[model samples]
Target: MKRKLLFGERMLLGDGTEPFNAVIPFRLHGIFKEEEIRYALGRLQEKHPWLKALIQYDEQHIPWFQVPEATVSIPIRLVNRENEDDWQEESKQEWHSTFDYQTKPLIRFVWIKGEVVSDMLFVFHHCLCDGGSAMALLYEFLKVLDNPNAEIGLENPILGIEDVVPAHILQSGKKQFKAKTIGRLAALAIKCIPVGRKVIDRQTDYLIHWKFDKKTSEQLISYCKSRGITVNTFLGATVLEAFRKVRGAAAFNKVSCPVDIRRFAPQIKDDHIFAFGLMIVMSLNQKLNFMDNLRLMQTEVERKTAKLNPYITMMVMESAHDALKNFTRLLKRGKSSNDCMFSNLGRIQIPDQYRTFSLETVFSPSVIGPLGNTTTMVTSTFRGQMDFSFMGSEGYLPQAEALAIRDEIIGRIRQQLDYKTAS
Candidate 1:
């Protein structure tokens, strides 16, 4: 479809801040002919409204999908099948993929026809869909490829921004809710408790990604389970341990690990597909031994993971939005309080068969972050291996040192396992 950019797409163009997006891979075995593939793409476009449309207007990053309601209807690109040369040149332009900002959602495919191999990639705005939505997208495209006559029937489409109320409006009993939310954070920042000297870091930053074989990732998971510690905590503790070795013990003692708030609730929807997490920092006032720290960390991770609530996180995000929109003070303050951040998407299930083919080792993509000195870590377990990727600015933490830190932590985990066996 031919059209001007959608409002959400334009916001990204203006701000130059693409939300970190995900990439999906698919393998094809000879099924539908090449002519059939092209026909399927055209047919699929008519079936899925999202495939043919773009955002009408955007408030912040939220979008209101508009259907033009007029003489001319805007159309979106249906296929993003690019060759290897294109991805090579494109990768150079996205130098920030290593560290500057989050990845804009995109899919890169490796398709081979006869003796010729073709590499195709597609990028989408994160505001448009999450990982689950991407899964749905894959099927939509597949349906078109499988049968040009297939109909688009969405079990549940991506939620419109209207589905969620802006946080500013407190329901009848929400006034007190707002007060408590603000009160807790306010006390943390302004209270008599001395968190520590706040350092205004003014350093340029960068981030890069790494991958481990599927076997190693799986082994790590099994090892963690044997220890009765969550894989995330095991990996998280590894980071803290590495920092303690490099930045010194004092640094590691005070760091907080990120906790995803989804599993904490009894009936959380798999599609509540938004970000919600908290970091639980430890007190460094006292000394800690290596073994002691690990035991303590295991306990902390379990407790905090259980206590998180999505409702509260959603409420806080809305409150922050209201603060920025209404109060000049918060607008000037920039980002809400969040020091270092980490997230892990356990294991994404790959389809058993795709066009009569299967996935090889899934290539892990790196996440980009704000240039501010903030540190962020992301992990995904594919097959039996757990892959860890790090993002940080060169100004705050050198890439050379960051890689060394990762290695040392992995070594420590292994060392601990050895010590137990000898006994």
Candidate 2:
């Protein structure tokens, strides 16, 4: 079975030189037998058809998820762990590693073997799935890894926009005319605009990861609840503040927040392997007080998120597919208008205790695309602790500045909680 790549997915595929990969690294507190690991992956591939497929380009040079008659298991690479941070180093390497999508599956694994603790990195081409889909796969992988006989049901993926947008909407001549007009206007504008010159020279990318203690994590959650704001909104406000403070007032206050499309489109199942993303740009009003700014930001987040129309956005993107190459060029050359991309995976629902192995910690997933501006901060709470993984290139955000921003964000959150406790 094969399906043409979605407009969003094709954008990630780029010129095929740079890989857009997402890696989820988690620590396990038990030894994993090599054969058993392979068996578990084989079972997972059997369940999800996309996991066993490779990317193939048709004569028209369009990419497709092509499933061959011969079964191909997701490959696993083993690295002898020297210390606790071996996985971190391996993750950096994986970020730079390009996938041979023609011959191998879009997903692969890396196992860092330690004496008592092992860290496994689940790496996938970002075009194949988003962080949400990756998390679902991780959950099932653990379940099957712990028990080979475990039954993790099959997934019915959204093959195309037809599956997501209702037939009535697609058939409406008014909607079709609107989409066509918008697409044509966009293409004309793109053609008329000059390609931006690449000014920033990106250096070797780095990832900084840390986890807040359970107490601090709980306090942060309580603080957000007390403010009547979602954790994501609160964190988004803090991130904006941190950049403004550390990178100076001139830094862009815009923070791109990705909303899972599954929330708006029920047809895309939770376990489906898909990569269409909906993003909302959140900005803070510098005139307001810190707390006041947070409240305003929270309100804006709620309002904008509620208004997001996944169907229209998907349709618009599909219409602009003809100008995708130009869009890619613009992205690669243009200066980043946003400070950073912030993603909060919320509290991870994966169990800590499995039958065979116990999950020690789940580091926030990180992905560095070849697109301009590699600064991204990803957060997720697992086992009652909030874990963060910050990725950036020196050219876009220096390592020292990134670390400072991380500390500033954490400090801002803690300071608010501390003040509340004292008052």
Candidate 3:
């Protein structure tokens, strides 16, 4: 049967960091048959267009890929020369880290290359797939290998959402209200806009990650239930609190949250889930104060959650080309991209069904930066625990400073969770 791609599929972000490459680490119990894995990817790529696309530039200074159906060998490079015991673990950073935008990553089959081969890491940029797409690919890959004739195909790529809906029209990517709604919201943005500030003093370097265990997770879950707030609402609160601690109130007026378009268009699948998702902006300043933060954030989050039947984000830029024009191109040359995007891809599924390996923790670090600052975060859940890893540039955010601020903020959440029993 003929397949297709959706609006999000064709839209990928590449001004700096490619937003679709996803990295996954898989453990092999037995020796990996190189040819079998190669064949598996070949068959998978034939069904997914993203793997075939390459990051290249045209004469116009604009970036676009000549997406074609091609199967490149998923090479596993083994470097035999190394002396690690002599230096600090920081010296071994290269093996564990990668520079943003460098999409083509080297896959290392640990067991084959050294004393251990069980932990194999596969890294890719988000230009290839979002969490949904990555999960789809994994499930399909495993299914295809298990059943060669399994019906595995993606919908043909089709454009659905505009890259950038004019802020003047939508005023934050939401379906702007009519004269009546506008009259109401205008009062709201005006009254609420004062406390909000544009983030200034961008830092350039940082290494920060936020992790939540099941106990904390359950506390948050219960807290949300008591307050009629979803975990997403709690996340919105956590994010605003984090930013307020660092960027201050400025994080409020300019926050962008992602809403999936698939709910609005079910016909689209993996290739189509690009940046076509919906966006809803909220006043982050309204989310200050622990109690008020929960109450206000819950309402705001609910407004967006009500639309999940539909999709924001640093991830927003993927489809931002929708608003791309000669005028915008000129204006954005020296401006920030979509303020600060807060993407909470809530709980994820890296199941333990495979006998070969058990699912451990899932770490998602968003590749976000523009206008000298990077403010993006992704959260994942594993074994009843959740961890959030944030990615940003050293140019706008010094790693140490970001972590310092992150720890202070994380401490607040811990305190809140600790008080849950008392409250």
Q: Write model 1 residue lDDT over 1-423, tens digit each, in one string.
A: 222332233323334342343333333434335565556544544444444444443455643443332312112222333552333333223433421112211222223332232232333334334444454455566655655556755333234322333344335357547745774575344333333233334244444455666655656666777777777666666676677677663353444465544355323234332323445654322377665655777787667666664455544544443233223222222332332456666775654345533333333333333322356666766656665656665545666777777788778867866676566
RMSD (Å) per prediction: 7.3, 1.2, 8.0
lDDT winner: 2
lDDT of 2 at 380: 99
When summed lDDT is taken over every stretch of 10 residues in candidate 1, the lowest stretch is: 98-107
| Reference-based lDDT, each prediction | 0.46, 0.89, 0.49
lDDT of 3: 0.49
Evaluated at residue 383, the lDDT of candidate 1 is: 57
Per-residue C-alpha lDDT of model 2 across residues 63-88, encoded as one tens digit per residue: 99988899878888999889989988
Model 1 segments beyond 4 Å from truth?
Answer: 1-122, 130-207, 249-286, 325-339, 417-423
Name the lDDT value of residue 208 in candidate 3. Answer: 52
Write the number of the candidate with greater TM-score, choosing between 1 and 3: 3
lDDT of 2: 0.89
* Residue 362 accuracy (lDDT) in model 1: 34
